[model samples]
Target: MDFFNDHKKLFSSALAFFLCLTLVICILPALDNQRVIQPLPNAKHLTAQETRGKLIYIREGCVACHTQQVRNIDMDQVFGSRPSLSADYALNKRMSFLQNTATLMGSERTGPDLTNIGARQPSKEWQFTHLYNPRAVVPASIMPSFKWMFIEKEQLGPNDIEVSVPDEFKKGVKGKIVASQDAKDLVAYLLSLKQVELPSNIPVREFLYKSEKKEAANSGKGGNLPDGAALYTANCVACHQASGEGLPGAFPPLKGSSVVLGDDLELYITIIMKGYNARVPEYGVMPPVGTTANFKPEEVAAIMNHERTSWGNNAKEVTAEEVKAIMDKIK
Candidate 1:
């Protein structure tokens, strides 16, 4: 009773109690988790440029709209190869003594999930153009342009990188849109957001409540052929676009491409599997989409067929057998 009457003693007792609770409930568990969990075996640490870009990303408040998480739901399948695991965040270190590392698992998804954006859209040119003016690449995009990341230069130096801005989105006052160092760093960071492959021993969690429509498509019930349009939308639409007309001066247009319409099936397959750099000065290097995604012969045929048929470019349809034969020869 005397101790309670002493306000300082009572306050000190209460403070000690709360501190004990915090240690038991918060700090202890966090330390235990850190000890038990480890980063994926193949996970790479951020490079100096990527780290700078990450800081810029934080400064730009990108975490406000985009999320770095992929929930274990069928809908989230588009964002990553598999559901995100606790180990995915185990490598995150504190920014400083005062600042905790941001997982960037944002509540609101005002934009698409960026868990695997690096793999989905790897082209630096596309990234630069998109950042300078979102509408330049995606006409229907609601995302605000971060044109401040770039500068208009009358003449570019030997090492300077330029963004290809279309006339419609230029909004007047034009010179070459040169990427600042920060912009390059930011793109580098964004391009490093690839999801690593889980080890073979680890059991993967399946996406829950998958739709019957998707199940039916995956089952190959109809003629045993995969959906070309779906494959294109998932793999190619980001750069080539739904209309098949790629962004001018960034991604090459597939609408009337001679390779797409040409009789040279082998060349087309090679480009898809091995990738193309012949038009580097005019266009960004096309990544080896087939190789990276481990695309099957059927999958490649589906994509090729989709490109050849879509956007009013009629050409001979390819079979999985033809694609497989070419892929084997190329390898």
Candidate 2:
């Protein structure tokens, strides 16, 4: 009995030492896990509205019906170059990326991958309409409507607005109808879900092209601004759109872009001539726009002039003759 009592103190001390050691090891790593979770250097946290929508997405049990990750064999190469990582969001500890992964312990895909669900369909109005009434956009959408997120249209600015927006939308909106702030935030999160490798290399240059040769060729065909704007609205607006905003990330925006208004007018001429189908890219490429293409050289010049000047952009005017000169090179 005396020996047993003496041994009890030693055993208790040993247990306490082991527990403290384990706590030290676990706590230290947890406090610093943010460093490991971040894939991008200095990646920012989700914006306020996106963070709110994330909560809504979780509360609605959307996770029960959808998956936010992709696998290599899933054949979603256009979704981007590869699958996602917890490090992609710096979210490894906040919630296990594995927890959000909805898959069949048995097997099922009742809903589509909501991984990059932001612009999976463009039009912000489409999201609102789909949420308010799914059957309106897709007769087959079985996902229940989230009418709770909507309200009737509200008045925007008093003096500047050309058209009255729905009570739901804010100024400078892009959707088909009205939109909620949460919708904008959710779209931001979705667009930010780009898991593709950031392109690190710039396109290699050969030689700069001068417009002098083309200008000499088009010596008599110079056209002005209004003609170009009219031509653009008539011919180019169907796909590229009236505002040049493009279809979000689906079609590239012409506003504030270098490639569209750049010095290489010849490159523009070739694409317009060929009509764009760059071999199975993510968003569908262009169909032929003229009789065999989108427009005549004069029309193309007018549209280019409109784009380079509109969207608060001020640049050199493109003339019909200039476009014709480039067209001749391509033909």
Candidate 3:
């Protein structure tokens, strides 16, 4: 009380001076630079739509459910890649003055880190369709579709900008006049998900996991199955007994099957794909697990080709490429 009473004038003068200094010296400086944002490595040059998506990602709070980095010592190796370095990020500008700024950097990983996703999932078409509708491929995905990202766009022509549809997608593009920019940008961002820092523990070969350049698997070439007798013994011996007599009411005999030598190869292909469970009610149903789905398309085609040409039956030999082309549609 005594101090305040004695220096009332002095205290008032000092408080006013401090307020003036805060506004003029500290606060005003921030208004110029605004918020300085730094991007992760490889994202330095962003497409226009990708840049928009980045802001949308922040706005929608996607970071709440997803993480962007995995530690070397963590148990998340199965679902994620390795940890990240700020140096790996693509800085818009040199950040030598981080010592002088309060950056907008946050570090909380709720969902999987997106650092390696673009490279992990290679198909841009798949990603776009997935974003448009996640429930289609993954029966259980938590991510929401940013459908607004796919608005129509135009291209600049000689005189001015005009809308057009390219020749390739013209057939099934629903005859839409314009293309989706959001899809293009989203694909750009997704492709940027290359993991340049894969650890040594990860294998050099895997189609399902890991980010690496891969040539498409060849599925159309002819195969090298064993001789007719050997293939019959290896594949058909269990169902059709060695005596050429099938198990009664359990398995149908292939010794006199008509479909084996049928004119329609599609029927044979269909039977192989859909497994013959009920058609041959006397025999249990054949499984529908596709060869291209789990095993290499070639392996399945080889077995089928061998089956159709065995047990006193002679049809055509199937090629992996033909099976692959067929699976392309079925898949």
Candidate 2 stretches greater than 4 Å from native? 1-33, 41-44, 75-79, 91-109, 153-188, 199-331
Q: RMSDs, each prediction?
A: 2.4, 15.1, 16.5
Q: Can you give the lDDT of residue 188 in candidate 2?
A: 51
Q: lDDT scores for all predictions?
A: 0.85, 0.52, 0.50
TM-scores for candidates 1 onward, in order: 0.93, 0.43, 0.38
**Candidate 1: what lDDT?**
0.85
* Candidate 2, 1-331: lDDT as tens digits: 5645787877887889988987898867865775555555544566666665665666667667666665444354323334555455554223355554222111234666655544233334445445655544444679886655544445443321122122232344443233455555554554444343433442222222313221212222353323655556544554456678654423456788675778777766666556565453223454344434236777677666667778877767677778878777777
Put down candidate 3 lDDT per residue, 1-331, tens digits, no spaces. 6656778777887899999999899898755434443343334465666665555555566667766654454344533445554434434333246432121233665445666666444444445545654543343567775555553334433432112212332344342232255455555656665555433653433224445434333232364532434434533444455545554544455656676656555555565555554554234454443431243556556656656655666766677677667656655
Off by over 4 Å in 3: 1-44, 47-49, 79-81, 90-111, 151-179, 198-331
**In candidate 1, which residue pairs clash?**
none
lDDT of 1 at 69: 93
Model 3 residue 307 CA deviation (Å) reads 19
| Pairs of colliding residues, candidate 2 | 125-175, 125-176, 153-166, 153-167, 154-167, 228-302, 289-293, 289-294, 290-293, 290-294
Scored by lDDT, the top model is: 1
Worst 10 residues of 2 by lDDT: 210-219
- Which is the better candidate, 1 or 3, if ranked by lDDT? 1
Rate residue 166 of model 2 by lDDT: 29
